[model samples]
Target: METLKLKKLSFSARLFTRAVAALSVMIFMAACGNKGGDSAPPNTLLGITNCATCATSIPSATAIDVFSAKNATGLAQFANMQLIVSATMFTPGASSAYNLYTGPVAVQGQFIAGTTLVDPAATYGYGNSCTIPAGTYVMQSSTVGQMSLGMLQLPELISTTGVVIRMRVDQGMLYKDATTQQTRMYGSVYITSVNGVPCSSSFSDVFN
Candidate 1:
């Protein structure tokens, strides 16, 4: 009877020790697996241009704001990244056009080019612009063309003299995980009129 009792006591002690060890391992892994949200680097700016036909050169004194958004499951929500530009323009409105390119931007606070992870669908037009999640992205123009004169309305006129033109660009970032993938829309590059002068601005969607 004494021998049997000793064996039972030893078995219980070992079981308890194993349980404690397993719990400790689980806690350590949980800490290691944690990852905070993505972040952007410093000194980033959103660029714009004014190429209206007869509008005065975009005042070098003008200022513009840039913002970012993210979409985790559904739509875009406002993000922390923001960019500003003091002035942007180009010589010979017809020849060069007022060009504004945002400052060098990066994600993960590292400022690396082409390092931003993006969804393949967002870049190819298969995904919606309002559904991108939080991540770093690169912006570039994809197409430029003239709009039909008939499409211009007095209220919609960007310039009274300059021909109405349009430029479409692919803008956003993509991210992928081991089991899932997501794409988020940051903003769109669209032509707008600044004081009835043709110009461009980038706007972001609000993620919810």
Candidate 2:
């Protein structure tokens, strides 16, 4: 009777230990899973799921044309010119992980160059990468061109003034090992409108 009682107590102890171990594993997985929703607002209508790069705030926003650069001469003088940009997106990290990224997430956009400013004898080359500080900018275009980030494609973006996008831009140096550092820019983007419709209230379904 004594031996049987000892065996039963030992089996129960082992079972309890296994249960605790399984629970710990489950908790760890949940912690590492997609926790994007924690930072998002309640009942928010967002088109992108698991949006790791959602903009919390847009401090500085402006419309930029290729002609804005002093070196980009003849761009405004020419018609039907194309302006393309290869941009990477980063989620503004928390205090603990400032300036760090989960991985490389990038987007590309093609625009019909605007012909508003004409600098005949303008200087060449991007003078400084810091000319345009880290902020939100709208790449103004004459026509609605295609913009894509991974599988998400925004085919039609229409506006009278061609306010196609509002993207967060940050400057960095590429080819760190090279003698001269090259400027690289990347950031998150938000499509504020589509087909001349604002993305709010009644036209909100367009985003979905």
Which candidate gets the maximum lDDT versus the true structure? 1
The positional error of residue 82 in candidate 1, measured at the CA in angstroms, is: 4.7
For 151-176, candidate 2 gives per-residue lDDT tens digits of 12222222222333232212211111
C-alpha TM-score for every candidate: 0.20, 0.17
Summarize candidate 1's per-residue lDDT along 1-208 as a digit string, tens digits: 0000111112257545643453444334333432432222245432333223212322342222222333333322333333222244322221101112322211111111122223233344543321222333333111121111101111111211223222232223222121211111222223332223333132221121
lDDT of 1 at 114: 22
Off by over 4 Å in 1: 1-57, 61-66, 72-135, 140-208
lDDT values for all models: 0.25, 0.23
Stretches of candidate 2 above 4 Å error?
1-100, 104-162, 165-179, 185-208
**Backbone clashes, each candidate:** 16, 0
Highest-TM-score candidate: 1
